[model samples]
Target chain A: MAIPLIQFINVSKNFGESHVLKGLNLSIYKGEITAVIGKSGTGKSVLLKHIIGLVQQDSGQILIEGQPLSQLSPKKIKLFYQKLSYMFQDNALFDFMNIYDNIALPLVENSRFPKDQVNKKVLKRMDQLGLIDIEKKFPSQLSGGMRKRVALARALVMDPEIVLFDEPTTGLDPIRKKKVHSMIQEYQKKFEFTAVIVSHDIPEIFNVVQRIALLDDGIIKFEGTKKDILDSQSKILNDFIAGKDI
Target chain B: MLNKLIEKFGEKTINLLKSFGRIILFCFSGVTNIFTLPFQFAKIIEHMWFIGTKSIFVIILTGLFTGMVLGLQGYYSLVKVGSEAALGAAVSLTLISELGPVFTAIMVTARAGSSMAAEIGVMRISEQIDALKTMHINPVRFLFSPRIIAAAISFPLLTALFDVVGIFGGFISGSMMLGINKHVYMDTVIQSVKIHDINVGFYKAFAFALVTTTICCYRGYYTHLYSGFGARGVSLSTTNAVVHSCIAIFIFDYIITFFWV
Candidate 1:
């Protein structure tokens, strides 16, 4: 039980009359890849958002490393952000910035690192991700897979302790999907950071995440290891495992 | 049929009111967030370059041409009234009271406002805004404030540039093109255009800057209200940003004039 790095305690959220998350309770252990799987609009991404205090739960608590998110002031929240990174579904690189600048933004904004150091660090990360050639290219110029890798590189640039991935393989082809999954695994191993991934692509994610949480109708219907997910007799889990309506 | 129509219209009107209310609330919260956060001088400089330096050429070109046209038109109209010497006064007054602020605002709304909406809209769609929140970064301070502050500072300066260039254009037209005495043209402008006229333009520019930035940021900030993604949504937000900001500028301009006069 290594003091679960993140916890959602009966967290709930509603968008108007429609509830997105319903009394959800889950904990994410450090250095583990936790996959949140559900059909579209089942609040997988919303749950990931709550963990990082992106969206406050309507009536519950979210704790990161034993500290409640709501209690932290805005300044403290910014400090907390330094320890977390997010990989957006669309790889939301500032289109105005070149890839090198995009990856260097957090460092330049938050860290005490000077320009030369930021450049060196960015180039080193880019090299690790095989993105050295596209350093000057904007996000629009990169392929979907390349964009995802660049986003991952940017997320890792700060050496964050937690990384949230929102649909890392949504629009990619099978080859690219595999590549993204492998990248996720590689980064998780190298950084030893808690990785919380939201994706409907269960099969691909199953190969990477240590544990899986199945969300249905705004609730966590089941939570267990990959073996438990594969062996479950629950109908909702069955449909999900069978790749029906995913 | 009348009842049904009233119901439909009532619903739409209420929704519109709600939207307006939300925009005001968002602006207030954004302002508060900016104050709550620690000042980042580097971010301010980055935005000044983006919002001010980048927009200079367009603003200058727009101002120059507007002045020239105003001068030519005013000269002809004053001549028709047998007061051709009043050309400079009319041109200067109109530029300072109206064109300088209004046209500059419209240009900014089209150039920066639309892009602001699109940028934030994309961030909304991509959940980068959420990422910021999760990272404990107030999107307002991180994203919105810089633009608002930049626009606030730039709009008045740009409007002054517009007035200067416009007045010069009028001088050039009255003296060189219309064959009016340079002294007469200069005297009319000096006599009629008081400090208050320039002050009015500056005030309006400030108001327009606030209106345009608020509308654009509000439109983009709450983009989740819109369903769907891709080019259509982005285009819708861009149009909304420009149109709403323009309308807001005009509406505020009227309000300010009502008081300032």
Candidate 2:
């Protein structure tokens, strides 16, 4: 078997009295979409944050490409970060910056790209994402779906090795949610980047993701392909999938 | 009961010390980043516009009125002592030595400092700062350093402007409104303001700049840890930043004046 692109070894986290994650172990492969599904406030987002170094685990190890994250040298860590992109639940676009500048920030800050080259890259991404005319418009000026597109464009602008999505279809209507999932699928194929999506979209998400992980009570209770999960005889996983209050 | 009181006091003291330690570290990070290479000139210039250029009108208005008041009062007191010719010396000296830097700092605290706190607080609550961090942009360098650089450069300059406008206001009130000869007033003003006095004013302005900007930025940067969340948290952070910065400015003013004197 190939080495997992990312692996969590008995990770744990606590916020004050609440234990958000407890000895949670998981692995993610390169060039595939893995969905982590759990009910609200079950630390699904915290788990995603841990993967991106936004939130630190209390114990255990997170290894990226067979190397433990905490052990990397500063320069190597910078390289690690360069390979990662996170799409926040809020989009987190700089409200003061217009769409073009927003999309160009990572490039402009990370590299000394000439203005024209930066412009070309941003415009190309904008064009591909159907965000051409709205380049000058601020994130606040755009509609929900359009803002989502801008976020995706900015995330993909760096051509990172891994992308983590935190509820990308949140607060959208059904049709828009489907569109967003489809957008994610299309982009993942086009870019061939490894993806870890934290979501609760259930059956709709099952179709989009290759594998599923069910998290409850601070541990991943199930991990397998969608077909495997559907055929498995796990009561807790079944109850969660059926939307029953466990 | 007494032990419980002592314990509670100890806890509070430790918490206060920790808070102070954090503030010092945060300010140190911002100050050190100001010297980091590949300087953030664009953001620094933008902050200078926000902190300095936008503050010109309010500084001028405050300086003029303060000087006018000093002239009116100084003229009356000097006439009683048969030294009304010394009115120019009195107003200019008071302004250059004390009021110019202090009032400019307070006015700036009310204007730009509050805005900095509120803006950063909003960004913190909204996770925009985290977004920057994830983008590999240091939030302290991107947000606070530019503001600190702007404040360090702008405060002394604004204090100088305040002193000049105030001296002019005194001239309007004394030489033009009253019967003091213009040349005598101008001469007394020129003779009274030693370079040391101007230095004292500027030193105070520089100190106030660091104190106010650090406190405001520190308060806003740590808004997530405060007692509230969301809008109320932001409001609390802004309020604490402005109130604490103003208080800190006065405290540092006294310390600097004590040492300089």
Candidate 3:
């Protein structure tokens, strides 16, 4: 059996009177695409946030490679964070910075690479993503799909081991949504990076995601491969996959 | 009814105090980040150009007119007392001790401070700040520290420019327009203005810089917490930044004057 790369053990979170995550336990394996599907406001995004250390869990522990995150020393924690990347729902590209600068920001802020080297790395990544002749254009100048690509380029520029995507295809047409899913699948294969996506695309998402975790009422109600989910006896889980509200 | 009234008032008071405490902590974070390694020198320079260099024309225009008005008014009042020859002393003293720093700060608050709030509020609402955090960068250090440092450097320079241009403006009204001796006007300004007055102006400029930039940036950085979400949030933050900074400048100016005097 493969050891999980990241694990959430009986974690919980509450925002005032509303409890978001309750005694949730999950594990993310290395180099696979896992999609967290849930109804709106069911703490799907919160789960992703906890994985990236944006929002800390109120209780329980998150372990990375069998070592608890809270127990890691400051130096180890810094190294741990360097191995993760996030793609926000809105892309969150710096509107003030052009394409070149936006993609190069992580390298510039985190590394001692020289100007030419940064340029070479950024240019190569942009070229591979087919982002040509738009280095000077700001994020606002790009179309929604193009902006998504730019954001993915920025996320991959650091060569992180895990990438968390929060609703990568919200507010897109069906074709664009399919394109985004394919893009994620293609990149996940090419880079061999672990992916955890929060999505609501229903059956469209099942095609790309190898594993599905159905969250309900502050806990993950189901977790398994697509075949296992289809073969399960839980009616609510089947309804959820059919785009029905539980 | 009486118990409910008291409870309401108490709640409001506690909330206000909590807000004040948070503002203080936010300011401390921004100032402390300046000493942190890999200081944002380039960003600071860019902001200085935006806040200081871009503001030269407006500062000059206001300063010149203010000096001219002081000369004219001082002439009328001093003429009544038969001491109109002291016009140079009067004009330079008013500008150097008080008007230059206060007016320059107000102008900058209106122009740069408001924009700072709006821009940061947008970034907060849009979660660009969070993106910075995910990249292992401190958002406050990246976004707020540069503006703070730039404002600190720019305010005193702008105040000095205001004083110099103001004195020259007084020359136009007192010596050139009103036909007072040019040498006498220039001589009185040079002779009567003490180093103490200049020092007070610079100190006030520095203090105002801290008060205005801190308030503006704090309001913007915590826009989500303060003003709900979206365009309304950004709008409210900008309004609060401008209003609070103006009020703070006046209050701080009075405090500084009380101590100096």
Per-residue alpha-carbon lDDT of model 1 for A1-246, expressed as tens digits? 567778888888998899998898888888999998888878887887676656778998887678887887888766676678888777777777899888887786665788889988999989887787888899899887788878888888888888989888877788878877897899789879889999877577889999998888888888988889768888878877787763
Q: How well does candidate 2 score on lDDT at residue A86?
A: 87
Candidate that would win on TM-score? 2
Global lDDT of each candidate: 0.82, 0.89, 0.91
Instruction: Quote the RMSD, in angstroms, for model 2.
Output: 1.7
Write candidate 3's Cα lDDT for A64-131 as tens digits: 98999999998998888888999888899999899999999988887678888999989988987779
Ranking by lDDT: 3, 2, 1
TM-score of predicted chain B, candidate 1 = 0.94
lDDT (Cα, tens digit) per residue for candidate 3, span B77-195: 98899888889999999999899999999999999999999999999999898899998888988898889899999999999999999988888888888888888888888899999
Which pairs of residues collide in model 1? none
Cα lDDT tens digits, model 2, A48-113, are: 888777899999999988999899898988888878888888888888899999999988887767
Model 2: how far residue B167 lies from native, Å:
1.5
Ordered list by TM-score, greatest first = 2, 3, 1
lDDT of 3 at B9: 100
lDDT of 1 by residue, B14-98 (tens): 9999998998887787667666535766666887777777888998787778878887888888888899988889888998988
Q: What residue runs in model 1 are displaced by over 4 Å at the alpha carbon?
A: A1-5, A9-12, A16-19, A59-82, A112-117, A170-183, A186-190, A199-204, A227-239, A244-246, B1-81, B168-178, B226-230
Chain B structural similarity (TM-score) per candidate = 0.94, 0.97, 0.97
Better candidate by TM-score, 2 or 3: 2
